[model samples]
Target: MIHENPPLLTRIRPWVFVFDGPLAVGLALLVGISLVTMYSAASDYDGRMFDHVRNLSLAFVVMWAAACLPLPWMMRSAVPLYLLGVALLIAVALFGDIAKGARRWLDLGVTRIQPSELMKIAMPLMLAWWFQNREGVRRWYDFAIATVLLLVPVLLIARQPDLGTALLVSAAGLYVIFFAGLPWKVIAGGIVAGLAALPLLWSVMHDYQKHRVMMLLDPTSDPLGKGFHIIQSTIAVGSGGIWGKGWMEGTQAHLEFVPERTTDFVFAVFAEEFGLVGNGVLLLVYLLVIGRGLVIAASGASVFARLLAGAITLIFFTYAFVNMGMVTGVLPVVGVPLPLMSYGGTAMVTLGLGLGLLMSISRQRRLVQS
Candidate 1:
């Protein structure tokens, strides 16, 4: 039974083949950027860079496991996962730990979990599954039903006062519905209706949420208070100018002027260090990843896979756009993190799962064609 050693690629094909090539490369680039940016941003905080590495490693493993799962199995588990997520969200609402004035985490004896993060993936999954089952015979009311499915968890998350997660979940589900053939008029009407309901929405919003919007309108109104974040972050971004401050030389980050340097405002650190050119490169990588996701969705093996892949792809876009917009003071701060760039375990894990699902869909398409 003695034999010569197998070629290196042959030995690793099973592992390597599990991921889509372009998507893997795009993620690797982002991960490398995250490490480099975090090193500078977390220089004053001992062990923060190490913790980021650990979080990234966990995210990579989660993504790999998700990529290995069969598409049929993913579809089969969709309903149960969605139900479990909703149940956990309900439980969190009933008896969750309040942290930073928001009840978003459920203490599960051993560790705490954010059920809303689960909805970021589960919402799209459930909706995709629903639309897939109704393919070729979908009615307008089917969209209505899908909207209800989307809203239940969204309202729950919003009630947790995590507007950021709620918005992300809503975007994820809406993308699925749109790709599943939502009408243009309906979308137009929804937008108009949403605009009409602004006053009501404002009245219901928490005071802090209202403050964020006001700060967006004028950060100088409370420069030393709620508006400080937008003020400081915009300085970091604009200070970068054309060629950047050259890596670790970023004054805003080094001087601790940029708030949340390691998390939500990491983009400000990145922008200050790398400047507009670096932001362009980062955005290109994101676009490549997003383009690969769209390709996967277009070539999906089933309607379920298509809708899920498309929704997940757009969710990545939303994360990046919102984070950067807030950092640049163009949009209201909503606590959204830069995808694959921010330093947080729960969000990283959720993003990894979404990426993994994309890989699975991509790999499945290849398998069928082959």
Candidate 2:
């Protein structure tokens, strides 16, 4: 008699998948709505940005499809995917398409892809896979090796002069290390050491990067230059105080008060037109997303699955927090786009890979249950 594999299409923790499916779909819808409403205003109805929205939505669909794969299969494949991602990042550094003074995209004939974005998903996956296989073998050398793995891509991305994405990517890698349950003392010591090295790190930043930090401190210093983006974003956000100015009625976006209105500054447009209630509701949905990811993380099926899910969850959280923080004048402008809602390809693909890992984990847990 031949044994049949459990139906891949069938319920793997039926309720778990359903809960995830709705949140994922809802996030996409909300993002899609934001694109339509914001682009109309930001583009002054030119509607050229519609194609960007369409492409991004398509990317989200791709992400959802990846998420449907079995978790163990994802775990098994994480290393190769990660290495490929790293190789791409390296390739971009040497022969990349430069725009706006930074070479961030690699032209693969049909697509101009950002490899750094791939690293965001790949780093956590790599670390999780590394830590998962380690199991009961806890050694400083293992930690060192994992740190090196994290550092390799981080340094390469940093060389691309993409400090923001590099920071976010590093955080994703660190999530795996932290969740591997390393000692508190070690974590604390690393923080202290890092703080001490800030001085040295600051000295090495590109001239423009320092200017951005300076601009963050005093945006009025160059109100018409680097400071312009922050100034406009703040006005947009503050203008939408309570119930907001309402949808297409946002003067900030409509009047061109915000730069990068469709991408990094989308939150400002969102806050301006939707106000506090909209912001709160959006945040609630994001929290639910995080909560679902956490449930997957804490389930403890395997270190690889748990670590990958945790890193991806934290990546989502970081994207939201960092983007909002920059928009509201609470954080430095590091060019981190908002998750889902931001109009960008690299970011969407990164999110997709992470979601795919989550779905894979959920599926594995389901199979084990059956």
Candidate 3:
């Protein structure tokens, strides 16, 4: 009997068949929603929509590439990746470009890059690796060392005054620390210390940062100045009520009242056009993704995989909550983009990497089972 070769498509497909099924489905759903919503948010339908599609395509490609890496490879890469991230951050601090008054980008004569975005992935990976190395001997000193590792990047990002990315990186690292069996008393003490340090934090904040806090408390103070974003976004959200003004019918967005409608304020556009019912559905999708990520974390085959997965999952929640809260005027405007919904390349790629890591962990679990 002649042995028939497997089909070409099947042979070619195995290399790309690495995603977690439910997570992939969830991401697809979000992307579909984003396309429809981007059409409405974009003033130039062809240009803006095309750019968004291009970024998303790149993001998906990155996600797939990330998913193909074995969990051990990822763990092994953590320290080197983190060290590179920190080195790049130091480079940014020394000779970075200034954009909108923030020194957060590095000009390498070829392209401009933000090193802080790397920490969004690197911080957790490094922390997970650290904890994994000390699996049986985790002690208070280990937690302290982890805190130092987490803080170095955070403080550097903050000095760059890219507070939004700093907050995200900090949260990602903290999640890892928490998952590594951090004490409840330590958590409570940290919360208290954070609260007590508010005065000092305020004193050191830049004028714009202070203004954002003030605006959150009273958006009407400036109306058309720094408060414009919060005021307009809140109007768009409130006017949508239950049923919304319908797709592409949001007066705030179409009339140019909603600033940054395609970026940080994309959630406002979504809320205005889709309304409460639409918001409910969108939130349900997010919840599904988060839930699936948590499941992957819980099912991970190793401590490193588990901690990294859990941290990345919670980071998703942080992005959504902070973006939505800022847009709704409940929180300060922190320039955080809505995950998978915003029109930006950096954030999209970063998030894609995160999802890809989750898929890798999930893939490892399945492989072990089989």
Task: State each model's CA lDDT, in order.
Answer: 0.94, 0.81, 0.94
Model 3 has a clash total of: 0
Give the per-residue lDDT digits (tens) of candidate 2, residues 1-370: 9987877666454533532554466566567556755575556546547766766767666666676666667777789988898889889988999888888889999988888887887788788888888999789988989999999999988988899989999999998899987889999999999999999999999988998899899999999998998999999999999999987888988888789888899898888888999899888878877887888788747777788788888988999899999998888899998877777666777776676667667666766777
Report the C-alpha lDDT of model 3 over 1-370, residue by residue, as the tens digit: 9999999989876467899999888889999999989989996545988899999999999998898889889988999999999999999999999999899999989899999999999999999999999998688999999999999999999999989999999999999999999999999999999999999999999999999999999999999899999999999999999999999999999999999999999989989998999999999999999999999999999999999999999999999999999999999999999999999999999999999889989988988998
Each prediction's TM-score versus the true structure: 0.96, 0.90, 0.97
Global Cα RMSD, each model: 2.3, 3.2, 1.6
User: What TM-score quantifies how close candidate 1 is to the native fold?
Assistant: 0.96
Write down the TM-score for model 3.
Answer: 0.97
Clash number by candidate, in order: 0, 2, 0
Clashing pairs in 3: none
Candidate rank order under TM-score: 3, 1, 2
TM-score-better candidate, 2 vs 3: 3
Model 1 bad stretches (over 4 Å): 1-12
